[model samples]
Target: MNMPLELCEARDPKGLYKLARAGKIKGFTGIDDPYEPPINCEIELKQDNGICPTPTLMAGKVVTYLEDKGFLEC
Candidate 1:
């Protein structure tokens, strides 16, 4: 998934980002360390209008991508 750093920090449910920012955690991604995005991926999930898709919807997207690529074929 390709989400912005601001969004991730804003929606931080574990408060890890907050901790990282406060120097409580070391080498945290997007804080002290860099976050490298995938160079090449089969399916890239991104936010739509700054809104993340639900888990069910994200799963459906994965299934659809697999089906389109014939990965689900038996």
Candidate 2:
């Protein structure tokens, strides 16, 4: 008897559709969609700090600010 070395996994289409609808997973190419705000406040505040801030500097500033505000994990 001979067996195939590679097996193709089959996904349940209905389960996938349900998960997408419930927003459990992101579907890059989906039929129905929910609308999120154009800007998230935290990220927007971080980006708006400077137009040409170096990534390292920006990261440091964000870390410092979050630390001062008691938001940083460590």
Candidate 3:
């Protein structure tokens, strides 16, 4: 990704969108690259509340998925 041409520009957490809007960065995934969301991913997590699941919590999700599939016992 190219440096923001406007040095004084404010940056979001991941400046990809901003840089893309300014046409500064090329070959940026989801901006210039072709991206297709997975239709049948095993695990999908949403972060709209900005609450990232801790590793322990994430492990529990995986364990639950596996248990539901009769892959293991608690």
- Indicate which candidate wins on lDDT: 1
Q: What's the C-alpha lDDT at position 3 in model 3?
A: 26
Q: Model 1: residues >4 Å from true position, as ranges?
A: 70-74
Ranking of candidates on lDDT, top first: 1, 3, 2
Q: Which scores greater on TM-score, model 1 or model 3?
A: 1
Against the reference, the lDDT scores of all candidates come to 0.90, 0.48, 0.61
Ranking by TM-score: 1, 3, 2
Clashing pairs for model 1 are: none
lDDT of 3 by residue, 1-74 (tens): 22232421443557766777678988765566755667878876443364555557777887898999999977
- The sequence of per-residue lDDT tens digits that candidate 2 reaches over residues 1-74 is 01111110123445665565578767523325533445535533232432444558767877887898899778
Q: List the residue pairs that clash in candidate 2.
A: none
RMSD of each: 2.1, 15.4, 8.5
**Model 2 regions more than 4 Å off:** 1-40, 43-51
Q: After superposition, how far is residue 5 of candidate 3 from its true place, in Å?
A: 21
Number of backbone collisions per candidate: 0, 0, 0
Q: Candidate 3: lDDT over CA atoms?
A: 0.61
Of 1 and 3, the candidate ranking higher by lDDT: 1
